[model samples]
Target: MEKTRAILVDITKCIGCQSCEQACKQVHGFPMETEARLSPTALTVIEEHGDKFVRRMCMHCEDPACASACLVGALRKTATGPVTYDGAKCIGCRYCVVACPFSVPRYEWSKLAPLVKKCDMCAARQSAGQLPACVEACPTGASIVGWRDEILEEAERRILGDAKYVKHIYGSQEAGGTSVFFLSDVAFEKLGFAAAPQQPMPVLTANALGDVPTVVMVGGAVLSGIYWITQRRVAVADEERRER
Candidate 1:
């Protein structure tokens, strides 16, 4: 089998330059800069925690809750490590948004036909023998990509070699592991990292969804349909108003 990929983020080395954020915007064609948080237009963002900066993006969970909650399989965790989204297959059901532990998926509220958005870790670039835009733009080697196992080994090496480093690897067990990992000098919580259960999030989602009555499931589908129609009408009305 071909090897899977992972990105190890060394928080200790990051200078908070925002180069990765800029490169992500350029590659994704996002004209507006979202300096604060992830949006449909912004795939990544770097936030300050005192002197330390933390980058946020899709965790690409090994068993993604977003993929599990997707009633229409629009979000899928690929074998190669990225969690990819298919807008064509998306029915505008934002269950993925609610299901995500990291709140990574963004819905385009202003668009006539909105799609969920997040980082795919530049899967196309990897296929073409290029690094992810964000990873390549990082000058201090804060973000480095490699085979998942190799990256895990590297993470451990850094922790062991340096006494100043935090003893924990953020993504190593979070949500039963993710394509992205973070290393830092201080406790993770102090750096704005969300507390994640070590158990795979999808498993929790599946159990919860399974217990719902069939009537509720049907009602959910109806509600999703209604939501799509409502969004379409609202967007269309706005366009007409602008024209008038």
Candidate 2:
């Protein structure tokens, strides 16, 4: 299998230029917005944190909770490392939105037939041997794309070499590791990053879904038995009436 691809975000290097945001909008053909947030049109956004600027988008988890939560398999994790969505298969259940730790998935409320939207790391471009739009547009090289393991190693190297960066590597183990990694000088919490559990969320979701079949079987048997008894009672009453 091909090694999973990933993106390294160096928060310390970001200049709040919003070039990444512009690139994302241009590629997706979304209208330019003054304030971008996770929405059907806006796939990525840059948020300011005091003196720091933090870029936010889909983390593209190794074991994505959204994919697990999807009943129709609309959301899926690609082997090459993007959590992609298939709108044609989507039933608009919005389960992915509720399950995502980063809350990256957004719904189109205005559309007659809406689809959930989030970044897929520019999967089409990656397949064509190109970097993601955001990464390509980053003039400061704050956003970079590479193999997951290599990116993680590079993030550690930078942190070790520079005193400005915090020791922790965000997305390294958060929610059982994500394709997108972040290096920051300040605490990640201050930059609006979620403190997710180290274990992958799919484990929990799988356990719950695994019981569904057994429940359905047991419930069906109980209902059938009740109906049988009811029918027997009615037959007995009719016979008794005829005998009387």
Candidate 3:
């Protein structure tokens, strides 16, 4: 019954305008960076491909590996669906950096006490019942924040209605269905979307980790059984020798 925090980015609608990126930096109160800061303060950035713009941002995965990898619990997802961070709890270990599939989280490597930073989906603004700065600033409504399920259905509807669309939703299946989704007219790879596998990136690693305890427990039990059987056999052999 509640609106889950989600962001929908339609590459087909983006016009290579940097307004969305600028709005994100401005709203977050982040330090002003040059156009080069495109990769840092700007949580989302648009890339020109032929004639269209491909915007990039954190996918905000339903099962975020970044959250899983954070030993200090700095990275977390709220019921509202925004993946948020707590700087006070962060030890600046950079586990989230390694775990992020989209490479969205950036560390302040230049600072003496470097901290990680990424999009919070303008959570404070959302709390005030407003849209994210990027979404509000998007001149063409290319980016809008809403519920994840509703947005996915809308993306599906667009693909079904438009024959020109690529028929592939970028974030729907990548990394286990992210809150952010994309519809593109051209190939997603051409737009610089990472070549994500059909399966979620974290799934493979998670499965491996899940099996570890099982494997160790089973292995230990089997070895113990074998040791007991061997000891029994040795005892029997010693008794046979004593009888002879």
Candidate 4:
């Protein structure tokens, strides 16, 4: 039995109260900081736009480009469907930083041995039959954690039932179906979300790298043959000079 996790974010329901951000910090045992500055330890945060507030956190993509870009497998999509990172395996290369489609992963720029961090969907709490701290803290039910498919279906249902919804599910198909999906009353662009490509981010790169093993083996053999022929030709030329 495979476990799949997801977060359903109804941006329309959010009141920008900042309780979810606080709950995330408390549940994760992260240190507190002043409201404006974001630290690597802060996995979730509230962003203000005019009179509205938006919450930002990792989307936990089904096929995370961060996991694909990681050369040493530092980032991985767990069986439970959360994209988790193992700090010990990270070399701080920052490839994952560039590869993330949602721009979810954040780096600690000030530290000597900086680490990349993001939300893990709170696997421990889910295991304990509890909801994620962010979900629990949301006063308006803005963020809810559940099955990925169900979340997507529900978001679609809402849009179909109400013409007021913008008719876009932010993470539904972006980066190959993110574990998290967002529903908004206003256009997502107005809320500061960039338009995402339809294809999975890794698919473009993986198509090229998929041939790497075969290309390397074939290339090595051809180069070896060329070297052998060059050496043999030099030996023959030397022999002819000696005969003359």
- Tell me the spans in candidate 1 whose CA falls farther than 4 Å from its real position: 32-34, 207-244
Return whichever of 1 and 3 wins on lDDT. Answer: 1
Question: Scored by CA lDDT, what does every candidate get?
Answer: 0.91, 0.92, 0.81, 0.83
Model 1: weakest 10-residue lDDT segment is 202-211
Which pairs of residues clash in candidate 4, taking residues 3 or more apart in a chain or in different chains? none
lDDT tens per residue, model 1, 1-244: 7678999999999999999999999998888555688888789999899999999999988889898889899889899999999889999979999888888899999999999989999998988999999999999999999999999999999999999999999999999889899999989999889898898987875666677797598999999999999999999999999999
Model 3 agreement with the true structure over 129-151: per-residue lDDT tens digits: 89888899999988877778888
Q: Candidates' TM-scores?
A: 0.83, 0.87, 0.83, 0.90
- Give the CA lDDT, 0 to 100, for residue 57 in model 4: 84
Best by lDDT: 2
Which order, best to worst by TM-score? Answer: 4, 2, 1, 3
- Candidate 3 residue spans exceeding 4 A from truth: 1-3, 32-38, 211-244
lDDT, model 3: 0.81
- Sort the candidates on lDDT, descending order: 2, 1, 4, 3
- Pairing residues by index, what is the TM-score of model 3? 0.83
How would you encode candidate 2's per-residue C-alpha lDDT over 81-138 as one tens digit per residue? 9999999999998989999988889999899999998999999999999899999999
Error of 3 at 165 (Å): 1.2
- For model 4, residues 75-144, the per-residue Cα lDDT tens digits are 9988988888999999999999898867778899999999898888887788788988889888888888
CA lDDT for candidate 2? 0.92
Residue 131 shift from truth in candidate 4, angstroms: 0.5
